[model samples]
Target chain A: MGIQNKYYGWRWGEEDPIFKNLGYIQNVLGYIDPADKSFTSNNFKELFYPGDFDLLQKSWKKYKKGTDHAFEMSYRFKHKDGSWRWIKESGLANVFNTSNNPIGGIGTIQEVTDKKKKYTQLKSILKNVSIIILRLRQDSNNQITVDHISKEALKYWNIPCETLLKDEGYLRNLAHKDDLVGIRSALSNSFAKMEFFECRWRVVSKEGNINWCQGVGTPLKDKDGTCFLDIVITDITKEKLYTEQLKVSEEKYHSLFQHSPQPSWVYDLETLAFLNVNSAAISKYGYSKDEFMGMTLADIRPECELENLEIQVQKTRENYLNFFDGYFKHINKQGEILTVHLYSSPITYNGQKCRQIIAIDISEKMKYLKFIENQNKSLKRIGWMQSHELRAPLVRLMGLINLLTDQDSIGKEERHYINTEIINSANEMDIMTKNIAQIINDAQLKEKMNDVQIIAG
Target chain B: MTYRLLQVDDDPVILFLHNKLFSKYTNSKIEQFKNGRLALDYILIDNGPDISYLLLLDINMPVMNGWEFMDEICNHGLENSTSVIILTSSADCTDLDKSKSFANIVHFIQKPLTKEKIEKLPLLMEYLALQD
Candidate 1:
């Protein structure tokens, strides 16, 4: 013991000599020196913190009015070692005066230096803790009272430290307005079940910024068997914000991929498995959405083209994350071979790496191209025939025409020979001209027949 | 040894002009046929390349075309026996390419064969000198 004795008893108020000596004042209040009786209530009250002594006085006054209670409180007092130590004064005031009024308080004082030091250290640690800790209780009237709150509560609750020991209304206001009903219900449930209660909600700070917090409360009981809710609060704002952003981005991508006009599908690159297909792809491929889901890319290809499709599939192993364009001969549900053009790119869908493909129906374009090529080939053939067939007869006609123009030196036999040759060459030129016309008409008819065959085939 | 000009064409007028033109210019045996088949028949019998022979052939004829005529001459091992000239109105490049494929076809000339074109032919010049 730091003092001569470890404990003492004393009484004051209601009487003849207010300065009566009580033995061992050093032990009674850790005073180190004898207590001076001349001090007023104001001088003695100076030893306590603001409003802390008032609670002890209220309990003492209540005990003096014939109530069965005591002034039991912990307050700071000066120790003999010139340091402040906590003292617990616990005793009832006796109503032993002749006037039936109280004769002041009778109590034993204990120097709670070690207990107070430990409690203060725990409180200091709780204040600096990352997560907020709270002990709350409900009274008989069902009014909730916060029994204790650590300094950490002010980090997100936005309440002042001084007001935390006095009022709890600021903490209630810190809760988001929309989440009050849920929190009240959970609190009642937790109290009734005497189990852990957990929930997450947004809290609005004094600066009007909202932060998400998760609270977990466990049931606890004080010395008087009164139940209190002991809760731990954690700021979960980062996780909550990440989840919200993920949902928003997923919605954006879904709208972009679904509403595109081109026929589109996505497949897993490793397995060639269809992961997703849009409406345009379903209609263009002549398959229902379910049918597409069940089939691979190889299913729609013609049987004869399987070998080529396999080669292309194997090549996909090396080439990744590139824009690829190709023309494929595809067979639809109607067994019609259509020329399809594809544009593909790499993407990640639902955590699966895949390639997205956009297909275009180029059957009509190919048909028109083939028609033009056929017409061009025939046109070249007709031009060749016209030059060769007509030039031969034209050359002979020109030569014969030169002979016919010479009539002055010509005899009768020479004139007949010239006339016969001229007539023969002229008739040949007429036949050759007719042959050129027939050749062009034949080429046109042949082209038309081929066009009809293509449509039928 | 004799040097001869074999003018094989389907047109009688072309053959007559060819025979008359060479006869007016030089003393050479000029044989005209209506087709390549008759010309080939004459070459197999009497006319051979013991002399410097010049064969002026047309591509499109009645019995045997110029290409078939060259094929037959090659089969008979007579491709080296005569120097041939292709005279035709066919302006197709494939025919020119086909004509060059034959060893006997030394020149390809287009129709309306002029005196200058005939004089310009090395085969004709050789045959004319042989005649002298």
Candidate 2:
């Protein structure tokens, strides 16, 4: 046995003091005796786990071929406590007969059950996480390479993990042209400061699809003194799209509000303070935007309408979600009373409950209505005068002429009286007609003046 | 019983025409006044329980118009004995409508007291028959 052991170059015997003292080596030392052809003795079959039998058989077949090389394999082994453990076995077949047939083999076994379990857990974590994790290493020569990449990187970027590890430029080249300088600067800064690194950039995948990505990394150092960066890249395409669309919509509405022809304003509901006023409001109210900002809704109301304004404000506060429309009297900077038609609606403005109001100046329209009313009154008076005052003399004239023509039994004196009466009635009708015509002419001139005023206005 | 015909107007020509028209239509003597006030005063002083009056009243007159005269007549309890026929040159529908509100106003005639219009007054025809 000693000569066979010496031939295998394993001089340590079962009772050797040095080997016995090395309890760690003693527990992992395993042997295969060529003399025991099937090698089933010494509890070999009992300690070998059934699941790893094929691995053991394959290793033994190489040894039986008389190949003089060291081989290593990982398999499950039964411990003394009846628990299965992952074991890494490394062995060399050195003992051979004169005929060159191997007689025995020696190997060392290492218990790696904890390391295997941790590796499986890490792999499972990497597989379940949606974000791509990349481990980048920088050597002493300042060369950087992708040391490890998660399975998600392969799925996300549509690039093979081996390809990324082999060609370090593959991932870097995927960065958008516009963001290349930013990526370089951020990386250099992180490396120089040994600080947390963060960058937002776009990446074009192998499928030619663009993706918005955010990369966050922590600079670290491995046991070997090599610098490393563990980075997590998250897909932010949806969020970026949402923010961009929101920006565009806000700009659109802002322009609409600013350029509207009617006077419009936004006021806080709780404070009744002006939050925003449009250009039209600025010009129409004769108040600058800064001045309006410092004033409340009551500032534009006449003294008599203040109480009504208070009541309306209270009602609006209670029904903040409702739309309101009304005609109100307002006073401007010039102290001219104006009739304004107001349209208001509730909205969330600058994160506050507020109402936006549009005011249409209708003072001129009211004036026009009043003018129409006065004209109608004048027309009615003229109708009464035409029916009664003007017709009275004309009827008298007709009657006198009838008397002259139809009455034949009258005397000369009566005929002379009737002739003078006819002339008097005719002269009366002529003056009255002239008076009515003058009155009508004055009314027409007034109407024409009003029409010109309206057109000019 | 006595029956009298009265003509009231602010216009002298209208009063003259009334006299001529009534003279041609009936033999009953007709009295004329320049305005409702004169005619109302005449009625106040001369009207008797046994006397009946038919007034030809003009609406647009100075001092106590036809409407005021009718109101005074009503206030004096003379509406039953005094019948009024509105005589004016007014073609106003509102005046016709206003005449309906006075119970004593029996006829609305647009004027110069034409023969046909006078002939159309049933109250005048009845008064003339009463005179006979």
Candidate 3:
């Protein structure tokens, strides 16, 4: 056999068929000089990148000392363009010197630069990503161990990745005291059932900063009674805070709407349906909340004012942003017509274009104003009677008295005539006084009646 | 020129007092009517073309009023022939203000037709001048 055949089964160096056919092997075939601690190959001087000679010597010595079955190593080599390339070498040491020390070895070297580049890119992505990817293993004895944990956990939990991998308790300890038991149970359940694991827990960092996290993953059970759970955890603190704030704001507005003192309601613009009614509205309209919910804006208005209500509704829709103030005659459930001053503002409610209205029942005020007008007329008539009618008879009496006083002596006929005239004038004066009194009494009675009607209505 | 004096009132006593006062103070014969309608009729029926009548008209009458009589007087084109002094018991300034709107009205006088009041009337003084 040839010297290459003595080393393995093929002749190495210039006669090696694998090395000569670069298309088939695409690898470097080389021989190691164990005494000189050097590698010799077809292009060894040009290809060997020099920095890893110590590592190569250490790996070769291990194989020579029977620590490894084959001489296997990975080192950097120079590419044609002067860039370093990863090379994986594997060989058998079969040649020995005279003293029985292994002097030569044959190995095949293949470039692994693309594979190393891919591995390096994956490592970089895992280290910087906000999401923490973790793999946990559990044995039949229920012993839980962290198989792998990404470095991103250190950025959030402020704990080292090595510390978390060696002792899974450090990662578990980062959970809030209240969530520790839950986290343990979640893991136990996923391992027992080999199902998907999903949990949200609070993590308190070493610096006392608390963050909300959501973890989701699946568990796979192995034939050796070991289960593996690969979970991806994300910080959900921002999302949780936003949801809580929204809830608080909604509750605050709901309380304001429910407890308002004025009769208020919200109605849909298109259908005119009553979407919401406050406590004051329910009581004032003499309708229950459920009843109001079933009614429309037109239902509360008098039939005579229905056309006006539609025109106003159309105006409100066209100018939604305008603050509306107007008057309407509304009829309650008891059929009492109410004059209301309606103030409305447009708002988006429950994803519907709606208007919130505050109705001030001014029916009593209107009645009072009418009563005052009638009273004014009555007073005018009384004043006119006092000036003209009532005073006419008094003027006649005054004239008669003057006639009587001007005479020193009077005839019997003259005296009787004057007395009779005075009597008639006094009678007229008495009747006029009664008429004035009657007018005042009638006005007062009408005012009292109006007051009663206002209170009852 | 012939001159006449007329007293129109709903109260008979006021007319009687006016008759006594006018007869004593002036030469023209005093005509009495219970209301404006009667006074207005007497003037329309008996008043001659040459006779200019001085009417003392009272407001607040049963049938017709001082203002209504003036309205009729103006409507009939008798505003030039009739001189009216509003004789009313009303102390209200509104009635006095209303009297100024009529073209036939001469002055406003508060009632009880007194001798001194009748003498002070400018249209009644024309009748008194006729007596002199």
Candidate 4:
């Protein structure tokens, strides 16, 4: 039907057309007259496009034949603001009249441009988020599955999603066999407690390289009480290696502390109380673990020397001295005095004031020194005798000879006889002096030779 | 003119040698005192000669020592007419050290007196002459 004829004679349509101008009809699809009560040829051009009308007409005919008739189409329509808006038209056709003849259809028109634009933006956001996020899901059976993994996770796995997602054992296969039991236990415990959990485990990738992963997981429970785990995993290979190194260093320190040779001790310097002592210290000091802990540094020092030691210790605390070494008399548990050469130094220990002391018993050394001193006194006495009492006689004998030689006026024969006697007496004196010197030299050489023999032995 | 020289010694041989050596070696009259006490008594007499005399003192003697005789004579403050020289066979450093404490002691001689040691008395005679 022509637009003008349909609008001029619209007395049998369902409702009066609210808009009927030709320019409006050309740009917009306006309503028809209610009095017309039937779709005619003139109104068909204004009501729907040729393609839409054909489709609706065909659908209406199919509906009369008892076929399905609901369908939708989209087209551009002019709005009141003079802009073309994309509209989606959806309708259900009813071709049954009072006599069950094919008649008309009704539909809904919706502007879908804003909805389409928002859908496009949401898709882009999802795609970008997929690049960095790794999502995992675990079923009620503790079966881990990659629900929505990031592209980065796929790259890290070095496998396509088709190959990875098809295997229900994919995550379990990636977990190190040694850590699988522990990881499962932790995850189960977290699920039971409904708490978040974090764990470190090794993952063997598709490329057969082991990679450490730190996983943070939270449980999601449905209304039916079915719980599933959602986890995020990150590569923690560097952190795991560093932690292992720290563990090794701690073990080394522990070994050194336990097996060091010197009898080392750590104590509270301010209180003069022991905090820790090595095995050597306990054994050397002749005290058991309980007994040693019950005693203090003062208890170890001799009673007579404690007062002087206290003064020195106080000076050390005041920074007037930092280290000290001296003789200290230590009484063992059996009440035996052990003369120890004690060396002590100040150090900060485990956030406490402390001192470290090393002691070596020097009682045997002192005994040896006393023996040497007595020997030295005897040697000095011998030296005095040789230099004084023994020298006087030799001097006097020479003096007498000098007097005899100086005499003048004597016969040659008598002089020669006196000279012979003088020479004989001088020779006798020389023998006596040589004997005394030999005695002293022999004593000194004997001592030296014995020392050399001892060294060689 | 010769003067009397008294030689005191605990050893008979040393006394004989001193007497022989002094008489033979010098122009002097000789007297003998075996003990320092007897010499001290004889020299302390009131009518003792004012003539020049000499006394030879022997230390380390049996009855009376040279140091004792010197102490007694000096203590008596005797105006003696004799010069004294200490004669001994002792070569002890203590004896030599002790000799320096006496001002009257002329000389310290070792034992086994010889002719040469006697001849060296000329120097002592010269010293005595200077003293007179």
Best by TM-score: 2
Q: Which ten residues in a row have the lowest lDDT in candidate 2 chain B?
A: B16-25
Q: Rate the local accuracy (lDDT) of all candidates.
A: 0.72, 0.76, 0.76, 0.62
Return the TM-score for each candidate structure: 0.54, 0.61, 0.59, 0.44
TM-score, model 3 to reference:
0.59
Task: Give the Å error, residue A42, model 1.
Answer: 29
Model 2 chain A worst lDDT window (10 residues): A1-10
lDDT of 3 at B36: 83
- Clashes per candidate, residues 3 or more apart or on different chains: 0, 0, 0, 17
Return the lDDT, model 3, position A248. Answer: 94
Report the lDDT tens digits of candidate 1 across residue range A1-457: 4543233334444421112222333354544344545334446556555676677667555555654545566666554355676656566555446865555555565557687889888777766655777777877666667777777556645644466556756355547888888887888898878889898877877788888888897877667767888888877888898989988987887777787787789988887878888887777778888888888888778988888877876677578767778998878777878788988888888788789988888887787787678778767867776667777777676655654554564568867766787788788778877876776687678778867977885
Model 3 C-alpha lDDT per residue in residues A54-167, reported as the tens digit of each score:
566666555666734356677776643456767566776466668766545566655567778887887788667668888889877888898877775457566435567777
- Model 2, runs deviating above 4 Å: A1-162, A170-174, A194-198, A205-207, A216-234, A298-305, A331-337, A409-457, B1-132
Could you arrange the candidates by TM-score from highest to lowest? Answer: 2, 3, 1, 4
lDDT of 2 by residue, B1-132 (tens): 898888888887776666676666677666888777898899999998899899888888887888888888888888888988898899899889999998878888888777787677777877766654
Report the C-alpha lDDT of model 2 over A20-59, residue by residue, as the tens digit: 2123322543323335232233444456678576666676
Expressed as tens digits, the lDDT of each residue in A1-457 for candidate 4 is 1222121222213332222323333433433444533344465344543365456446534444664555555554443444544445455555455875434545554556466667567656645432224455656676656666555444655443454556765556658788988887887788778789888888776677887887786878867566766666777787788989978976895577567765667778777887877787777778887777777888777798899878878887887337888887887776768788888887667777678777776765665565466557656655555553443344444444544555663456645655565565567567766776766676677567656754763
User: Candidate 4: which docking quality band?
Assistant: incorrect
For model 2, report the TM-score of its A chain. 0.66
Model 3 lDDT per residue over B74-129, tens place: 88788888888888899898988898888778888888877677667666777756
